[model samples]
Target: MRALYQIAFLACILFSCGCSDSNPSPSDDDNVPPPSGTSSFDIITQELSNDLTIDIYVPRVENASGKYPIIYFNDGDVFKGAIASLTSYKFEASSGIEPFIMVGISAAGHRYGRYIPYNDQWIKENWSDYSPGSINYTQRLINEVIPKVEEDYPVDTKRRAIFGFSLSGLYAAWAGINYPEVFSFSASMSPSFWVADYAIFDEPRELSNTRFYFDIGTKEWNYYVPMIESLENLGFRYGKDIFYYEVPGGIHAESDWASRLHIPLGLFLNGTPEEVEGYEIIKECIPSQSTAGLVFQRLNPIVTFTNGIRYSLSTSASFQVVSGDGVVLEDGRFDTKGGSMTVEVSHGNWSEHISLNNCNN
Candidate 1:
């Protein structure tokens, strides 16, 4: 079943991209020469400990001169290759992604040693080989890494961001809240939020101007789902820049992270304040756990709804439009119950495998 889904996805993606002109008509300034984006490296905090390599990607515009926002990425070595395509795509397409100075800080060879926060239970158990150095790492980034980058490049101090994946992703959240003065935007894609026994959730900290983006694959770990929910319950207002997303079939891998990187970047750079408002999910029938051979419709605003004549005979079957928090915003029994409903949604995207099963029984 997953294979068929992939096949359909690839077909859709290819068809969409293939149908569009590779080079759409350019804008007025399109003729201008592109910036001389440079990639370079430096060793940070040489005095205290092992030197950490920071790979910086600087985007230059030909005639423009001003400070640009900074996005510091964990796992710098991996993005050394991934950054080019991203910058190039921004230049080639009209996507709202902005070009910022991206600094990739390399994770230590012993990732668990540095990424893991100090915890007695974890240290005494499976992570005995490593000691937590998250504080030291965060210190180096604010004191050494940012200062070093700022020394040679123009940076927008007001709009700095830090992001990461997996273990380092956990670090992004810890550092963003703990040190809000240094980072305003923080994103953790598929973060190992369960680490240290959910220690981040144990204590509350004062947050000011701190925005967080947390996302993970639904297929990854069912237990991890509530970790994000706890963030919402802890007073991170959704429209106020704290957002959470779930990729239906996402996984813990670089490819999946790369594909969704634009979502966070877009939200930070050019997000529309009203995009999520009035968004609705309309479902005709909730599929059974063992249901199969069903047609799953992708969630969209323009989806046409039929009366579902085949299942209308059953009086007990129902329909619902639930919010992300599981609140039944709108619901009713099918047409057999003499109920009427109309839904209007806009500017939100969700992927759910909807199926109709045993409704006629």
Candidate 2:
């Protein structure tokens, strides 16, 4: 599935490039040069007891004198390669997206501890090897990393954005929420919001000044539903101050995050939303053969928008047993009698019919 998505994403990029005649060919057009950029590695010892590596990418803007917006990434080493590729593609395409400086802060040796908040009980209880010093890590980023980067490069301080995925994604959200004065925008891809049992919602947040971009794959929808609800409860209107995308078949992987990097970049840099043309209903179920008949261990009804965003309606959608004495369980599972069963799931205006056969019989 990951390979398929990666291929599709790459194909989309190639197709878009091929369709545009305005884009000059690399061989024929010396006037239009490829997007030029330079990257350098820096070591920061002031922030932590040990040295930390920072990967920075600054795009060479031709004749543009203005300071550019900057994006700081968590798990810097993981995303360092994608940053250059994504920026080059966007720059060459002239997609109306502005280029920004990207700083990848490596997790170094203390990822689990540094990514979560200081003194997080969840980390203590779950990860036995959880190191301490998230507080120091955050302080180092604000007091040292940001300052050094700004001093070294021409950066637009007003448009600072933070990017992270997984645990780092949670860190990004926490940073934007807690330190709105520092980061104006946050993009969390497949954030592990289940951390500390959704402790992020324990207190009210003033989100008027902060913008957030969140996305999760349909497979990971169960973990993010609470965060989505909390954001809505906090008055975050989608496509307004916050953008949420539930990617169909997206998993907790770097490849998935890299594929959708353009969405948040375009949103933050160009204020453009990935346009939604329509939506399709996808029905999925995992069935296990029982002694009596067959049972569905999981029932997933996903609504995939044309824009590549997917929403899981499994828990929210209404389900009915259409035939064969099948019953929809309270836990959203399905059980069948001897022969076969069919279920119809409806959410809003979308509906899908899922059929399950009792192969055991």
Candidate 3:
């Protein structure tokens, strides 16, 4: 999102003879490229065994900026455009999650023809002709693509991620499962794990540093349920091996996946794949029993810095950052909503205290 700036220029025409017209500050009307300070991109063509075209989205950054994480999608055709559509960049522009360089690999149509797991006879019998036998695509991604993406982008290979849906969904899981050494996080939406014979978990070894997100709609599910059930069972056995989400009245359309796309995207890009069971949201809120006129309308998630210091919260609808330490750095209203916030804070050497005002009299 670009910031809107309205610079008004007032000209006093005291000696313009006949007439005087008010002229405001001329705005920047050039067709300049959006600031590439946050992200940029280039097309990569690989002349390997499987000649492939990789669409890399380079996160705009400086050399001093440390490495960022990578999130790759297999069915690039379906998932690439999804990046901008999901406003992932906008979310990054927001304060909570960290920015990531997203790479969407367009399936050049060979998607179904080439990428499938196990190449088992049962897969061929049940779901079309699934030629499985160590998906070479995974190898390309891990060995070649990873290197290529890392070479071009400032990426931390240790924090790589992969995600997909349907056919590629299965590819995502299989690649991450079979080659855990490559992807740190993975998510499968309505994966065809049921397409194969032996269950996904049963055919695996101890998973390391790999977190999975399994999601499916509850509606329009006649055969998908079994796959979901099997995954849930496996997750139970494997603990945080999977992050399962049973979307109520879920559908197979893009609308459903669209609604839930951010879940996996965020998780893969910036979440700990920890085993979570019976999630209970504990909202320790200081009720807005304001007896005064000033009050907050909304309160987003409180931000926690890696420095082990937690920010103070104001209310439910939105929280105002009172201060970094205890001194006020910003005077008057400081906002963080609609991409901005109003606040008053103090500045100090290392730490200061946050003093919040407007508590109902």
User: Which is the leading candidate under lDDT?
Assistant: 2
110-167: candidate 2 lDDT, tens digit per residue: 5666777635563454344465455677899988789888997788888999988766
Report the lDDT of model 2 for residue 302: 49
Better of 1 and 3 by TM-score: 1
TM-score to native of every candidate shown: 0.63, 0.66, 0.56
Error of 1 at 89 (Å): 3.1
What 10-residue stretch in candidate 3 is worst by lDDT? 1-10
| Per-residue lDDT of candidate 3, residues 226-258 (tens digit) | 332344444423223445554545554444565
Candidate 1, overall lDDT? 0.52
lDDT of 2 at 146: 90
After superposition, candidate 1 runs with Cα above 4 Å error:
1-50, 62-65, 78-85, 92-95, 120-128, 224-235, 272-361
* Model 3: how far residue 265 lies from native, Å: 2.4
- Model 1, span 109-228: residue lDDT tens: 645655667564543443345667888878887788888889877887888998877666777887787788888898887666656556665433553687877775644432333433
Q: Which 10 residues in a row give candidate 2 its minimum summed lDDT?
A: 1-10
| Higher-ranked by lDDT: 1 or 2 | 2
Candidate 2, TM-score vs. the true structure?
Answer: 0.66
